[model samples]
Target: MKFQNIFVLFFAVSMFFSTQNIAAQSDEVVINEIMYKSLKAFDTNDWIELYNPSDADLNISGWLLKDDKDTRHFAFPANTIIKKRDFLVIIESKNKFTNVHPGIENYVGSFTFGFGTDDMVRIYNSNLQIVDSVNYKSKSPWYPETDSLGPSLELISHELDNSKAQSWRPSYVMHGTPGRPNSATHTEDEGIDDMLLNVFPNPAISSINIEFDTQVDGDLLIEVYDVLGNKVKTILENYMQSGYYNSYWDGLDESGNPTPTGIYFIKVKSPNGILNTKIVKSN
Candidate 1:
C-alpha cells in the first residue's frame, strides 16, 4: 500500500509539470513577420499575411481582429492550425484556394470582409487578449505595390513617402526578408496641411452629414461618386470659409430623386488634393 501511494503521488506531480511546460511553450509563440502585398496607393483588395517562427502550431481558434467599440469582430475558427514557420494569407473576399492544406481549411475560411481605410484592426488570441493591431488613421509601412494576382508572397520594400496616404500606419512587421522591425518612434506624416473629412450616420437610412477641417479659406468641392466613378450628387461646389463646415445629403440623385441602396464614395476635393471616403446607404 505504501509503495502504491508513492507511485500515484509521483504520477500526479509529473502531470502537473507537463501541463505547465505546454502552457509555457504556447506563450512563446511569436509573430516573426507580417507582410502586406498586393497593395495600391490609396486603394487595395484588403489582403494581408502573417508569418510565425515557432515550431509548434498556433491554435488561433476564437481569435478576433476588431476595431474601436469592439463592434466589428473578425473571428478565427478554433480548429485553425497554423503550422510552424509558415505563412497565412487572409483576404477580405471569399475565394477557393488549393494551396492551403486540407486540415487548415477547417479552421480558416475564405476571407469575406474588410475594414475601411480609416478604421482600425486589432488581432486578439483565444483568450480575447490583444496580440497585434494597426490603425488606418496612420500611414502603414506595408503598402501594396501591385495587385494580388502577381505572386503568392511578392512584396515591395517600405518607403517613406509623405505624398501618399498620411494617416495610415503599419502596425507590425516581423523580422524576416521583406519584413523589418519597426522603430517605436516612427510616425505617419503630419496631417496639419491636409484637410480631414468625415461623414456620419453611415449605413444612413435617409440622410447623412459631411464635415471637414481646413486651415485656410479655399474652394471645397464635395461630390458623391458611385463605384464606377460617376458623379451622383454634388453637396458643395463653391468657396467656403476656413473653418468647420457641415453639409447634408438626403439620399438623392443628380435630379433630386431617391437613390438606390448601395455603396458610394464621398469625395472632398480642394486645391491641395482630393480625399475620398466611403458611405453605405440602406432602405
Candidate 2:
C-alpha cells in the first residue's frame, strides 16, 4: 500500500515538471517577422526572422521549420544557439538576397521552398512537438501592403500574441528588418517630421518631380538607386532650411546619359529622417 502511494506522488511530480518544460519551450522563442512577398521593383528572395525574447540563451539545434502542409521543412544545424534578446534570419537564397542588398551579416540557412501568400509557419522542437506557429495572410485584416512591393509583416511586440493578425503591422522600412529589432517596436518621435516626400507623375516619361517638407535645418541629399541598389543619379544635395522644397530628375545617369526605362528608388535624406519612394520611368 505504501509503495502504491509513493508511485502516485512521483508520477504527479513528473507530470508537473513536464508541463512546465513544454511551456518554456513553446514560448521562449518565436517567429517575429516574415517577408514572403518581395517588392515588384527590387524583387528579392523571401525570408523569415526568428527572435528569442527570453533572458537565457536558447540552443535550437535540430529544431524544425515547416509550412502549413508540411511540404517544406528545414532543420536547424547543430550548434545553433540564439542569444537572449537576439534575432536570426532564414534566407531562401543567400546569393539572391545578397545580390539585392549586400553587407547583411546576421542570418542562417537557405530554405529551398517559399511561403504562400497566405500560409502557416510552424516551429517544432527537437522532440517534434510544436512550439510556435503563425498563420499569416496577404489580404485585408492583415496589412495589405505586405502582399506586394511595400513592406513585410512585422510583429508589433515580442510580448504580444504573434499568432493573431492584429498583432502585426507593415514594416515601416522597405524590404524588412531582419536579424534586428522589428521596426514596429520602436516609438515614433513626435518632434521629427514624417518626411512626407512625394514623387509626382509616377511612371514619368522623361522627368520626375520631387517635393518634400523639412521640420529642421539640415543638409538634404536625394539620390536615385536602381533595382540592384546601384546609385544611378543624385537628384539634389545641399543644405536647406526647414521648409518645403521641390527637385527634379531628368531620367538620366550621373554621366548625363538617358537611363533605360525601369523601376528606380528615390531616397530622400533630411534633418528629420530618410525616406524612400518608388518611381517608374517609361519610354
Candidate 3:
C-alpha cells in the first residue's frame, strides 16, 4: 500500500513539471528574423522568419499571425508542425519566395498581407493567446539600410531579447538567410547621420507625438496611412529649416472623425531620406 501511494505521488510531480515545460516551449517559439522591407530591385515581398528552440516538435496548426489592429490574420494550415530546433518562414507571397530560393520547403503563408517599412508582427496560438511578437523600424537605432534595398534584419542570437532594437542587426548579405542559422555579425554604423525618429506611446489611445531632426533644410512631408494603404491623415507638409521638429496626431482622420482602432504608418519624408514608423491606435 505504501508503494502505491509513493508511485502516485511521483507520477503527479512528474506530470506537473511536464505540463510546465510544455507551456514554456510554446512561448519559446520566437520571431527570429524579419525581412519587412524587400529590395526594390527584387521581386520578392515581405517575409517573417520564426525559430523553435525547444526540444520537441511544435504542432502549430491553427496558430495565426496577427497584423496591426487585427485588420487581417493568416492562420496556419491544418497539421502544420515545426520540428525541434528548426526554422520556418512565413512568406507574403509563396510563389515569389519559391521562385528565388527553390527547394526550401519549411515555409508557409501566401496571404495577401504586406509589411510596411515600419510595422509589427505578432503570433497567436489557437486559443488566441499571444505567443511572440516583434516590432521593427526603418530608421536609426534600427538598421536604416533595412528601410529599402538594404539587408533584412537578423536577430544577433536567438537567446537574446528580440523585443529590443539593439538585439538585431542587418544581415550581412542582401535579402537574408531564411530557414537557416543567422551568420550576420556586423557592427552598427556610427558615422551615419540618423534622422532620430521617435514616435511616442505606441498603441496610443487618444493621441501620439512625433519627434525628429533634419540635417538639411528641405520640404518635409508627414502623412498617416491606414492598414489598407489609404491616406487617412496628413499630419504636416511644410518647408522647414534643418532642426528638431515635434508634431502631434489626435487619432482623427481628414473628416474629423475618430480613426478606427488599428495599425497606422507614419511616413516622414525629409531631405535626408524617407523615415517610416508604425503606430497602433487602441480603443
Candidate 4:
C-alpha cells in the first residue's frame, strides 16, 4: 500500500473515533428527575433535574431543554458547569421554587410546560446534536400515581436506560428532592454490603412487617428512630446471613411498650449503606 493512502486511512480513522468520543461526552448528562405535576402548596413550581454521570465536569451552558411540542423551552446559562456526579435543577418558575427551597440557588427558572400530561423532553448540546430525550406519559412505565399525587417521578439510575418507565419511580417525599439525589437513588458503591429494607402497614394499628434483602454478609443493625432523630427501638443487632430476611416490630420501643403516633423512621444499617423508610403508628 502507498504511504499516502495509509496516511489518509489513518486520518479518517482518527476522525471517526473523535466523533464517537464527542457523542459519548454529550450523552453523559442525563435527565435525572421530572416533576411535571406538583401537589405541594408550598412548592407549586414544576421542575426537571439533570445529572452529570461522567467522571469529568460537563459544561451544559447554552444547551437546549425543550418539550416535544416546542411549548416549554429553556436555554442554559453560559459556562454553566455540572460537576462530576452532581445535580442541577431547572424549574418552571424561580419565584415559586425559591419560595420553598431558598438555599438551593442552582436552578434555572422561567420555563413552562407547553403540553399536557403526556409529552417528551429533549436535551440538545450547543451544536444542535441530541444528547438525551425522555418521552414521559401519565400511564404505565412512568409512575402513574405521581401524575396526580404529590410526589415527583425520579429516575432510579442514570446509568440505566431512561426511556423505559421501569427506570423511574415516585419520590418517597412530596415535591421530590430537587437539586439533590433522588429519594429512590440506590448506592452503587461496591465496597460495602448492599441492603434494602421495606416496612409495610406503615400506619399500623398494632404491628408492622419489615422485610430486607442483603447482598453481603455483615453485622446488620435495625433501629427505629422518631421524627426527632431519637432512637426509639432497637429491633436487631446481629451478624446476618446475606440474602433475604424479615423482621417484625409490634409498634413497640426498646422498653417493650407501644410507641406514639405521627411519623417514625425504620433504619437498617448494613455494609453497603444505610436503608431508611418511614412507618406511621396510630392508636
Candidate 5:
C-alpha cells in the first residue's frame, strides 16, 4: 500500500507539471508580417495583407482588429485560420470573393489610414487580449494621419528576407485607395466614375448640412425619411450649379416643428445618382 500511494503521488505531480507546460506553450503568440501599399495618407480604403510565419496554424476566429476609435471592430470568421507560412489580404471593397481561400471576403474587410501616417492597427485574440499592435506615430517613412486620407499597410519582404537572403521573394502584393481613385486615365469601360456626397454633423442635435459635386447642371431633391419609409420633409427641390453646393435642414417635419429623437435617413437625388445616409437626432 505504501508503494502504491507513492506511485499515485508521483503521477499526480507529473500531470500538474505537464499541464503547466502546455498552458505556457499556448501563451506563446507571434506575428510574422503585416504589410500593405497605400496611395495617400488618411485613406482607409487601401488593401492590407497579414502574414503568418510560424509553423502553427493561427486560429483567428473571434479575433478583433481595430483602429484608433475602436468603434469599428473587424471580426474574423469563426472558422478562419491562417495556415503556417501563409498570408491573407483584405480589401476595403463591397464585392464578395468566395472562391479564394486566403482571400478574406467582404465580411472580414476593414479600412485604414494609408502609409506615412500616424495610425494604429491593433489585433485582439479570442480572449479579448491584445496580441499585437502596430503604431505609425513616430515612424518617419510612414505617412502622417489626417482627416482626408487614412493610412495604408504594405508588405515589403518575404520569409527568407529575415536572413538577408538574396533569393527571398515577397509572398504577395497589396494596395488600397483613399477616396475613389480617378478613373479618367484608364479606359472608360474599365473605370468607375465616382461622385461625392457628404453630410456634416452626422449625429446632429437640431439640424444637418448636405453637400455634393457634379458636372452637369440639374435639379437636386433632398428628403428626410424615417426607417419605416415615411417621408418626413423635403428640404430642397430646385436647380443647382454644376459644382459643390450645401444645404441645411432643421430636424423638423413639414409643419416646422421639432421631430422626436430617433433615427432618420437623408437622401439626396441628383442627375448623377441617389445617395443616402442615416442620421441620428437627439433631444
Candidate 6:
C-alpha cells in the first residue's frame, strides 16, 4: 500500500511537470503568415504576420525576430499590443505595400531584415528568451511559387504547427492578407487554387481582357487600379457562380474618360480569397 501511494504521487508529479512543459511550448502570439516574395517582382515587398491566439491581448513589446544564422534581428516596439485574435503585420517596405493594401496601413510596421527561401525565424521575448520559432521552406510540399510571383505562405490554423510545411499554404491574394485574416485559415478543404486567373495581351493598346476559372461560387469584387493606385474603375462587384468568367476593360476610367497609358493592377476579391495581377496599357 505504501508503494502504491508513492507510485501515485510520482505519477501526479510527472503529470504536473508535463502539463507545465506543454503550456510553455505553446505561444500566445504566433507567427501566422509570411510574405517573403512579392508578385510581379520578388524584390518588391516582404512581410511577416503574427496572430494572438489567446482571448486576452499579448504584449509583444521588445520582442525580437532573428534568423537561424543570427545575422539579422528585428525588434518590435514597446507596448505593442496584439489584440486578442488579431494580427500584427511587419513589412519590409511600408511605402511599397501601402499602395496595394491601403486598408492594412494602420496595422503595418516596417522591418528591413530578409527571410530566405529556407530559413529559420525565431521570436524572443523581452527577456531574450525564445518564445516561438519556425524554420520555413521554399521547396515542394511547401509551394515553391511563393518564393517567386506567388501568394504568401500563411498558417492554416493556429491549432496546427507554425514550423511544418503542411501547416502553411499559399495566400490567394497577390501580396497577402497582411494584418487581416489569412486565406488558409478556413475550415473547408477547398483551397485558394479553386479559382485561377490569367491576363493576356498584358500591354494592350486599347482594351484588355481578364479571364479566370473558378471551382467554387462566391461573391467577388473586381476593380482596376492605375500605377498610382487610383481606382480607375470597378469591373464587377457581385455574386459569381463556379465557372469561367471574363472581365473586359476598354482603357477607360470610371467617368468614361480615356485612361492614361500605364501599368495597372486588376484585383479580384471574394470572401473566400483574392487574386491580383498587373497589366500594362500602351498607347
lDDT of 2 by residue, 208-270 (tens): 999878877888899998755679999888998888888899889999999998767787877
Give the distance in Å from residue 117's predicted Cα in candidate 2 to where it truly belongs: 6.8
Per candidate, the number of residue pairs that clash is: 13, 0, 0, 3, 27, 0
Ranking according to TM-score, highest score first = 4, 2, 6, 3, 1, 5
RMSD (Cα, Å) of candidate 6? Answer: 9.5
Q: What TM-score against the true fold does each predicted structure earn?
A: 0.37, 0.60, 0.57, 0.62, 0.36, 0.57
Which ranges of candidate 2 are over 4 A from the true structure? 1-28, 32-47, 77-79, 91-120, 125-195, 203-206
**Candidate 1, backbone clash total:** 13
Task: Tell me each candidate's RMSD, in Å, in order.
Answer: 15.1, 7.1, 14.7, 7.8, 17.4, 9.5
Best TM-score among the predictions, by candidate number: 4
Estimate, for each residue in 1-283, the C-alpha lDDT of model 6 and write its tens digit. Answer: 9999999999999998754422232357788888776666534477788888776657777878887767688888866777777888877787777777777753546777777888887888878888878888888677665776556888888888777888887765556788888866642343357777777897799988888787777887879976444689998888889898988888899999999876677877766676666676888
lDDT of each: 0.53, 0.80, 0.79, 0.77, 0.52, 0.75
Q: List the residue pairs that clash in candidate 3.
A: none
Question: Candidate 3 lDDT, tens digit per residue, 1-283?
Answer: 9999999999999998765433322777889888887766665688888998888778788998976759788999986778889999999887778876676889998777888877889999988899988887888688766666546889987888898998997665557878888745432222126466789998799999998787777888889986445799999999988788899999999999998887677878777566656677888
Candidate 2, residue 99: CA error in Å? 10
C-alpha RMSD of candidate 2: 7.1
TM-score of 1: 0.37
TM-score of 5: 0.36
- Better structure of 2 and 6 per TM-score: 2
CA lDDT for candidate 6: 0.75
Residue 21, candidate 2: C-alpha displacement in angstroms = 14
Error of 2 at 1 (Å): 28
